[model samples]
Target: MHSIPKHMPTSTVVSASRGRSAQEDPWWVRWTLISLSVLVLSVLVILPIANVFYHAFSNGVAAYWNNLTGDRETLHAIQLTLFVVPIAVCANVIFGVAAAWAITRFRFPGRTILTTMIDLPFAISPVVAGLMFVLLFGAKGYFGPWLQQHNIQILNAWPAIALVTTFVTLPFVARELIPVMEAIGSEEEIAAISLGANGWQMFWRVTIPNIKWGLLYGVILCNARAMGEFGAVYVVCGRVIGKTETMPIRVNTLFEGGTSETYSSSFAVASLLTMLSLVTLFIKIALEHKTQADLKEAAQTHQTE
Candidate 1:
């Protein structure tokens, strides 16, 4: 048995003294929460981004414009980022899709071990990832001397940068697509096969359409990571100024070099990246909404039928 206090509710008694409400979450609490959130955001994300934009655009609109369109080295760095992002993302996309399919469709020895291995990069430091390639491909590395004798140069080259980026970003696409694939199940695929659909047709019609959102989500995330990869690229590519410098590597060099002229360009690149990330975020949201809407329409159609 329980007893309600005399001052408390029989059927929600109203308190007329001191204006205290029955609910604990008052307007003051809400405002307090909003204020706290604004404070933290102002310190963390907003401030940093504002600083970048301020530096990027501070020297007037024309200077920001010139930061991008005027500098050849900066232009080259941007091109390198563009080139590496696609290659790294595509490699990861293929491997990730395959890995997801393997995990969902088959039972095999060391499957759990392999899945854990996929998450290794997430746990380990990026500096260690660079060291891994360095140990494998550096001048006196395990096979480095042997290869170098024959004029082979995997390290300090674009291939090394691309490979390292691909390896590091590999887990992103698979991580995104795996749960979606597991939830969707292979029943539709089996059904497509039973109805005499070919492999390509079944995949295109049944497999891709369902998981397209997840795939896109993974690709966007991976591209973001690949574009900004620095430690590994620095180690492997040797930061050869205009040649091997991606956006991040270029920014670090500019920061190190004290190039005031390049600071705005760095911020411009950063802002460009931020814009791409926002676009990716929107795509993910739109796809998720569309997927939900499609599911609802399907349920309605079935119910009506």
Candidate 2:
């Protein structure tokens, strides 16, 4: 039998015998923390959403429906959001996959610079990101004269809206994919190549399945931001109602117009946005749980192998 070392604290020895049970917080402390979190979420998130639905339908269903459907501008804003989100999501997905593949699979000069460039959009203010496009495409901008001479319209146009939305949402997919790709490594990719699989086939068979969840996670985040983007889109849109207005802009327009139904219309449109956020939250939570399960399964598989 060995004695406890003289340097070892008596408290530490007692705690070691008690194991992890010794470190557990008192039940009241844990319950207090749980109560605080619930209270905060109820006040901040749940209450606001409930209020949006309340204000939205207070005047009745027809009034709410008319606010969304009767106004041509509101309809157009909806259409515009529908148009921009898909295109931006597709573009980002393509760029994200390519960039992640290259960055994770290759070692090269300027690799760090390239990664930094990918993250620049996230670091910059959305307003500043929108301004960069304006300075590039505005009438007095560098290519503005040439564009005008060519009769090309970008500023205050759908293209400008898409461009700014894309800029503001650039990092989501790439950020999601990089770590997954890094973890999966190139072992399977090398094996596929040796077995005569083409690059596309290798990606389809080996890479995609490994990273599909991550890709989906990224796409979800990218889509949420693309649809919800306001600041960058606001600057680039010139707030041309019915033409360039997105859902967020439409909500702002209604609130600021100061009519009898202004509050109703704004909140009604805002209710649509709030619904979108709630849907996004649900999807994100589901994906997070799925990802955790996948990670756990993969770890277990690795250990077995």
Candidate 3:
């Protein structure tokens, strides 16, 4: 009787065969899927971005430049976006790092609940988040009377914009860090503590270095979202032309003006946002490659040891 080969298990052989069969699609089917994907991508992404730039510079490059800088409201919207995004990103970074550290390093009750809550923004609509803030701080909201008595403004102000932005971007950093931290495990941290390092030193020296790439990845995503947010900001900001209007809100306002100039200005502002997204994409890709390289090096070092 023939004996079974020692190198390949029965289960492995069966799974390999199954995988091969699954991948054995006809040549036409494979090409058709690839063609469909490219077509869809061109329609959904490539064409829209190209169209924006086309209209933005339809008159001339000078027109696009003038629209971006000549308009006071557009300039203010750009400035407001610059101001708000940093505050939101900083707040989220602090919260994200602390939350990721806790969730990864300890065992406690309600951990699952805490994890779920981190994902709440993704599950819920930004519009709902905006409405929730309005309900709490708007002129006729729950605290509206108290706010009015004190002559304090939350809704329709920069503060409301910042707060809503922070809420919407709350998860990016933590979500990126959690799996990274979990995969790396706590052995290095434990070893550091054992070697007479203090808690802060251990975190700054060991943990931060280990997770820096992931942290940067998360910050990029958070910054992108904070800059591009519309619905939540719109609801709370009340689209007060210059003061509370962000770049996205400015784009919408210009688009609705229903004139050749306004249309050109809108696309010009949109092109700036698109350019930012493209830059972010490039940086994100570079970080991913760096991260994978670090991971591979670590794995190789471990094997040698």
Candidate 4:
């Protein structure tokens, strides 16, 4: 012991040597790599966002303010986006929790097929997604006659927009939840049951807390997609000036030729979408950190137990 063991492990020596080698890299090389990464990020992401802001205010703050405040269509577009985002997010949350719980908590035939079906939206184009709904609800659609009899409006309406948006963004939450639920396992639920917790109690107290971060991550992604949805919403919306147009559609409309719309108006609306994306990024990063911390805490707790 006093001699610190003459036969020290070779593995330890090798690891120390590797660590030293890694730490010995020149400071200039490290800085060069970091600077390169930052430069690339600035070009790919920052530059475009800067361009949007520049164009949005090119005519000055008064024009930008008027584009937002004086435009009824723009206001409706914002309202429509706000409406769809919450509803779509809520629906996806319910579907995600149910689907994830069903898949992870139970074993049954066709489970794989069911999961593949859930991911079909991701595989298909958003335009195709809109087309599917159109076929189901259009005037000549399968339920078209029934819907007509019932005086139901789906195509070129808010209903169609919501439905198509839902279809396109359906996979996010369930996809996020499946892996998390699998890793956490059923042991906690079993234990909670043994301790006299009911189904709802066990889920609310044990499962929800563990999966909340992943769920939040999924919801954020879903919300972003729902709000930014263009192809599907555009297809089904019929671009009704103020009734069914969302922020994306509004931005697109603003740039159409033969219209009185200016580049500033279009870019101004676009900046809103860009800002939403930035906000989503911020939330996602924060949630990722929180998720990592929770995972570490859970691991430590499990080890202690």
The deviation in Å at residue 204 for candidate 2 is: 1.5
**Segments in model 1 whose C-alpha atoms lie over 4 Å from true places:** 1-24, 291-305
**Which stretch of 10 consecutive residues in model 2 shows the poorest summed lDDT?**
293-302
Off by over 4 Å in 2: 1-21, 297-305
Give the per-residue Cα lDDT of candidate 1 at 280. Answer: 73
Please give, for residues 1-305, the per-residue lDDT of candidate 1 as tens digits: 15667766655534443346545577789999999999999999888867877887889889888877687877888998888789999988888989999998888999889899999888867788888988988887898998789988888778788988987888999998777777677877998999999989998999899788788878878987898788778878888887888888877776776667766677876777666767877777877776566556545655665
Where is model 3 more than 4 Å wrong at Cα? 1-22, 294-305
Clashing pairs in 2: none
lDDT of 1 at 207: 88
lDDT of 2: 0.90
Question: Which candidate wins on lDDT?
Answer: 3
Total backbone clashes of candidate 4, pairs 3 or more residues apart or in separate chains: 0
- The digit string of per-residue lDDT tens for model 4 on 43-140 reads 99899999999998888899888988789989999999898878888898999999999999999999999899999999999998888888999999
Q: Judged by lDDT against the true structure, how good is candidate 4?
A: 0.89
Per-candidate TM-score against the hidden true structure: 0.84, 0.90, 0.90, 0.88
The per-prediction CA RMSD against the true structure, in angstroms, equals 6.2, 4.6, 3.8, 4.1
Please provide, for model 2 over 93-143, each residue's C-alpha lDDT reduced to its tens digit, 9 standing for 90 to 100: 999999999999999999999999999999999999989999999999988
* Model 1, C-alpha of 210: deviation from truth (Å): 1.4
Residue pair clashes in candidate 1: none
Question: Better model by lDDT, 3 or 4?
Answer: 3
Give the deviation of candidate 3 from the true structure as CA RMSD. 3.8
> Rank by lDDT, descending?
3, 2, 4, 1
